[model samples]
Target chain A: MLSQENRLSFFLSFASLLGVLLIWQFSTLPQASRSPYGIPDGNAEYQRLMGRSAVASTVRSDFPTPGAFARNAIEVLHAPFHNNGPNDRGIGWQLGASLLRVMIGYGLATLVAVPLGFVFGLQPVIQKALNPFVQILRPISPLAWMPIALYTIRDAELCAIFVIFICSLWPILLNTAFGVASIRREWLNVIRTLEVRWPQRLFFVLLPAAAPTILTGMRIGLGVAWLAIVAAEMLVGSSGIGYFVWNQWNNLSLSNVILAVLLIGLAGMALDAALAFVQRSVRYAE
Target chain B: MTLFPFSRRPYAFRAAPCDHGPALACQCGSTYPGIFTTGHENGLPTGAMSAQASVPAISRRHFLGAATGSAALAGLAGLFAPHAAMADTAPSGVVEKPDLNIGFVPISCSAPLIMATAKGFFQSEGLNVQLRKTAGWALIRDKLLDGSLDASHLLSPMPLALSLGLGGNAAQPIRVATMQNINGQAITLALKHWHKRDPRDWKGMTFAIPFQFSMHNLLLRNYLALHGLDPDKDVSLRVTAPPDMVANLKAGNIDGFLGPEPFNQRAVYEEAGFLHVLSADLWDGHPCCAFGTTASFAEKYPNTYRALQRAMIRAAYFMQEPSNRLEAAHIMAQAAYLNQPEIVIEQSLTGHYADGLGVVRDNPRRSGFSPYPYPSMAVWILSQFSRWGYLKENIPLQETAQRIFMIDEVRKQAAALALPAPEDGQNNWPVLTVMGQRFDAFHPPSYSKG
Candidate 1:
C-alpha cells in the first residue's frame, strides 16, 4: 500500500540506524594484543600493579557498547514498576513522577497565561507597560533561579514545580497575545454591527480565532517544562527519572544512565506528538 | 461424659512452680503469697491440704496459689495493654516525638545512621525514623536549618562552623551528639601521576575536597604544608561533591582529591586513579563525621533527643564488632541506601582492599565507628579554623568546644547503656602527634608567620 518514495525513505532510516550501531560496536571491541611497552623490564607484577592487564582493564570499560546498552535496556524495562525504597524506584514510577510534576506545572501556567495574555492583547497600553519586565525575565535561564527558589520556598518538591512553572509561562503568554491581536479586523467590525455583546464576541469570535496559535504556544511551553524538570530533579534528588540518572552515575553505571536518556527522549517526543494532534483538531479552513 | 475432657483436672494446679525460692521467685512470687494466705485464712479443709502436701513436694496450698496468681496477673496486664501500646515508652523516658526525619549523604561515613535504621535500633528506642538520602552536604545544611530535617550526618567541624556563622547564612547553635566515623578518607590521584609520589615535585596541580569546612580540607592543607608546599600559592583546591570526584578525575579535570570513601575506592575500581595516601596515615584517629542536630531541637524534645542518642550509640557499638561489618555492608548496598556495589562498600568498611597497585592491604583502623564526642577534638578543629584564617577573630577555644561537643551528655548516655566510658582526663586539651610532629592543643602553632 506504500508509495515507492515512502518505502525507500523507511529503508534508508533503518539502514542509518543499523550503520550507527555497527560503528559503535566495532569501536568498542578489544584491540589486538600489544607488547607492554610501559612496563619496566617486562615485569608481569609491574604491569598488573599499574592496572594494565588486558582482562582487568576491560572488565568495566569507560563507555558501554551498543550490545551492552541493549542488554541493560531490556533488564531495566523488564521490571519497570518495582519499588525498592525511597531512593530507588523502577523507570515507570520515575517517569510517572516526572509526568505528574510537568502536568501540574503546565496546567497552572495555562490557567494564568491565557487570561493575562487576553488582557495584554486587548490593551496595547498595558502590554507596553509590562513589555520591559517580560523581555528581561524571559531570557533568564530556568536553572538560574534555583538557589533563590530553594532558599525562599524551603521545600524541594515545591521548588522543582516552581521552576517548571517559570519556564512554561512565557511562550504561552506571548503566542496567545499575538494570536488574539492578529485576528481579522473585518470580523470584529461585523460582530459589532450585528450588536453582539462583549461576552459573546469574546468567546465565540476571539477564542476560535486564537485557538490554533494558543495550541502552538502550549506545545512549546510543554517542551520547555519537560526540559527543565530533569535538571531540577537532578539538583533536588529523592525520586524521579533525573534522580535515577544521578543515582546510577553515583554508582558509575554508565549503561543505565544511557538508558534513562533514551527514555526521556521518547517521553518528550510523545508529549509533542500529543500536542500536535490537539493542534490539528482546532485547525480551521481559510 | 465431660464436654471438655481436660477440664476435669485443674490446669492451674498442674503447672510447674517457680524454681527460684519464694523470696527471689520473680513476678510469679508476688501472687503466690496472696493465694496461700487467702486459702489458709478461708480455712480450706485440712484433710485435703495435708493429703496433697504429703506427695513429697511443696505444700499444695502454695503450688496452687502461685499458678492461679500468675494467670490473674497476666490477665491484668492484658487489660492495661492499650496504654502500653499507645506510648511505646523506652526505659529512659517517654519519647515526646517519636516520628523523626534524619538526613544523610550516601557514603560509608554515614554507616552508623544507615545501620541504625536498617537494624531497628531506632525502633527499639521507640522512635519512628525516616532516613532521607540527600544530594549533597549543602542541601543537608540548608534542610537542617530550615527544620525540614530533625537531625543529619554532618562533617565533624560543620557544627562549629555553623555556630560561628562562617559558612552558613546565620549563626545557629548546633550540637554534636556523637562522632559517626573516624579516618575514613583518602587522597586519590589520577593514574597519570602514578610516578609523582613526592608532594614537593608537584606544583600547580588542582585537588578537590568535599567542602571548605570539611576535615578533608584541613588535613590536606596540613599535609601539604608539612611537605613545604604552600597550599594557597602552590596548589589549587576545588570544592567538588563526592559523586563527581571520580568522574572529574577520569576527565583529567583534577590532579587528585582528598574525599570520603567509597569514592576513593571507586576511582581505583574504575582504573581512573590510584590511592596515594590514606587519611588515617596522615593523622590517626582523627574525627571525620558527626551525628548532629540544632541545640533548640535538643532542648525542645529532650527525651526524643536522648532516645536518638541511645539508638545511634547502640548502632555504633554494633558496627564496632568485626563480624557484623559484612552484614552492614550488604544492608547499606541496597538501592534505598548507598546504592553502590556490595564489594566497594565492603572494602571501605572492612579495611581490606585493592590499593589499585595490584596490592591488597589490611589495616583494621582504616575506618572506625566510635560514639565518643571528645571536647579535645573540637578544640583541635577550632585551632585549625584559626590557622586557616576562617575565623575573623579568635574565639575562646575551650569554651566553644565545651558548648558544642556535649561530652558530659555522651558520657551519661554511654554509662546508662553499660558501655565503658573513655578514660578520665581524655576530654581535656592534650598534645597529639600528626605526621611525625607534635601538635600541642594547649598552645596551637602560629601559622601567621607564613
Candidate 2:
C-alpha cells in the first residue's frame, strides 16, 4: 500500500533506530569510557558489584541500567496475570483502579457542570454573579482540596474522587458555557422566528452547533482528570498505582517504581487517545 | 478453651520427649530431633507428617546421641518430614485449623510475626501460617471483607468504626478475638513547633496525625480538651502518612505528629522532633492494637479462630524474650515489606518505655500489664466513639462492646493453654502512672464525661 518514498523512509527510520541502539549498547559495555572532551565517568559496573555505590544504585538495582529498565517496562506492560510471585502488585490492577476513579469523578463533574454551564451561559447576570467564586476555586490547585476533603468528608477514597472532580470540572464548565453563549445570533433569531420550542432548540439546534466546543472541553477535562488521579492517589495512600510506586520507592525497589511510572504514562496516553478519538468523531457535525 | 493467660514461654504445652528409634527431620531444612516421630504415629497416617509428629518421641539421651549424625539424617528426613511439631504436648480441641493467612503491617509493632515464624510457635499448633504485610488499615479492612486475610493486627477503633457504619462502609460486624500489643506509641512534636512554645504549654499548636479517624487523633483531641484547650478553635490538625511525618517534620512543614514506634524514634534520632506525650499519658495504659476479624469469619471457623489465637499468644511470648530482640530486628530487616535498617527497627522494637514528658518506665510493668482480651477495653473504645461524634447518641454501649470482644472464646483458648485467666470479669481496672501520680483504678464513664 505504501509509495516507494514512504517505504524507503520507514526503512531509514528503522535503520537509524538500530544504529542508535547499537551505539548505546556498546557505550555502556564494560570497557567503554567517556571521551576526553567530557570528564571520564567512573566505572558503573564496579560500583554495581561492590554494593558500596551511591544510594540511588544501591536502593534501586535497575537504576542507571537502560537495559534492565527496558526489560522491567516490557514486563509491566503485561502485568496482573503475567506476574508470577506473591509480591507482584501488578501494573494493570493499578491502572484499572485509577481509570475507574477518574471516570466516576469525571462523570459526576459532568452531571453537575453541564446543567450549571447552560444556566450560566443563558443568563449573563447569573454568570457574572458566580464568576468571582468560580474564578477563586477554579485556579486553586486540586491537591490543596485533600485536607478539607478528608477532614470534612472523613473518607480518603471519596476525598481522592472529589479532588479529581474538582480539577476536571472547571475546564468543562467554562468551555461548555463559552460554547453555549457563542452560538450565532442568526441561529437564535431563526429559532425565534420559527417559534422553535426552548427544549427543542436546546436539544437539536444548540447542541449540534456547540458540539465541537464541548468536545474540546471534554478532551481538556479528561486530561486534567488523569493528572489529578495520579497526584491524588499519591496523597491518599490507599491501593492505587500511585501508592504502589511510592511504596516501592520506600522499600528502595526502584525497578518496580520505574515500571509503575511507565504504566502511568502509558495509561495517560491511552486515556487521552480515547478522548481524542471521541472528539474527532464529533468534529464533522460541528 | 481456658480463661487464664499463659506464661511467656515459647511452647505452652510441655511433655516428656517421646522415645523413638531416631530423631525426626523438619521441612525447614533443620533437624529438630526428639520433638516428633519420623514415621507412622500410633497407627496414624503415613508420610513425612507422621515422621514430624513422632520426632518429639525421642528421649533426652537419644537427642544428644543423634546431634552428631543429625545433619545428614535431617537432610534425608527433611525430604520426608513435612512439618515440625508446634507444642511439647498437644491439647485436646487445640489443632483447629492447619493453614491460615494472617495480616500485619510492616512496622516495628509487628514483632510477634517475625518471632512467631522464627520460633515455630505456629508450627507447634499444627498450623501453617502466612504473614502478609498489608499497605494500610483501609486495605486491610477490604482484604478482610474479601477473605484475603483471616485475621489482622488492627487499630483499636477499627472494629467499632466498622460496626457503627462510619466512613460510609456497610455495617460489617467485627470481633476482637485477641489483643496483640499495648502501650508503645508516642506523640512527637516537631522541633520547630516545640521551640515556639514552652515545654509546659501544649495549647495552640497544630499537630499532624496519620488519619482524622484514628484513635491517636481522638486521644490527642481528648487530651487537649481535658487541659481546657479547644481542639477545633485552638489549633489546626493536619493529616500525614506515618512514613512521611519524619521528612515533613524535618522540612518544618508540620508542627508535630502522632504515630507508633520507630517513626517516633527516627524523628528523635534525626533531631527533627522530640516526644511530646506518650499516647498512654492521656489514658493510662490504653489498648492500641488487636487481632480483628469479621463476625462472619468468627462464626464460620470457631475452632480455627481459637487455634489462630493460641498461635498469636505463643508468638507474643517469643517476642518478649530478651535474647530474641536482635534476631527479631534482623528478620524485620530481611523481610521484603519492611527491609529497613536493623538499627532503626531495633530502636523501636526495644521494649524500653519513656513518657513524652521525660518520665521513664519499664515495659510490662508489674503494676499494669493487661495483654489478655478484655470486654472493658471494648467498652472504653465505645465510650470514646460516643465521646466524639463518630457514633450517634443512644447506642447500647455495653451490648455492642460485649459483641465486639469474644471474651468467652478468648478465655476458653487461654484456659486450654494454661495461661492466666482474667482475675476480675471486666472490672474497673485502675490507671497506673509513669509520668505522674499513680492510681490503681479508673472510672471509665466519668473519665469520658470529664
Q: In candidate 2, which residue ranges exceed 4 Å CA deviation?
A: A1-240, A248-263, A266-286, B1-102, B113-135, B142-149, B164-171, B194-200, B279-285, B351-371, B389-400, B418-442, B445-450
Quick one: how many clashes does candidate 2 have?
Answer: 32
DockQ of model 1, rounded to 2 decimals:
0.23
DockQ of 2: 0.08
> What lDDT does candidate 2 reach at residue A164?
85
Per residue, candidate 2 scores C-alpha lDDT tens digits across B118-223 of 5676676667877766666766776676676777877767887887787778888888877665555767877545433333365656677766556667766765
TM per candidate comes to: 0.84, 0.55
Candidate 1 residue-wise lDDT, B1-450, digit = tens: 222122122111111223222322133333223111222111112121212111111111212333454455334434443233223222347889998999998999899999889888788778999998888888888889889899999999899999999864689999998878777798898878877778886689999999898999999998888777788889999999887899999899999999999889888777678778776566656779999999999999988898888778767766755667899999989988888878788887877766765556565556667677766678778988888888878787777876888766664554344333333322334355565566665566777625
Residue-pair clashes per candidate, as listed?
A: 0, 32
Model 1 clash pairs are: none
**Which candidate number maximizes DockQ?**
1
Model 2 per-residue lDDT tens digits across residues A1-286: 9999999999999999989767766555543222222322234432322232354222322233568668866765655644322334566766777888999999999888887888888898999999999999998887788767765666567888899899889988998899889988998899999999989999998887777788788888888988888878776644568766766655545667767777788888898888788777767532
Looking at model 1 chain B, report the run of 10 residues with the lowest lDDT sum. Answer: B53-62
Candidate 1 C-alpha lDDT tens digits along A1-286: 9999999999999999999999988887765433222312224543443345646333445788888888989998999999866766899999999999999988999999998888888888999999899899887787897888889998888888998899999999999999988889898889989999989998899999999999999999999999999998888857788888888887878899999999999999999999999999999986
Docking class of 1: incorrect
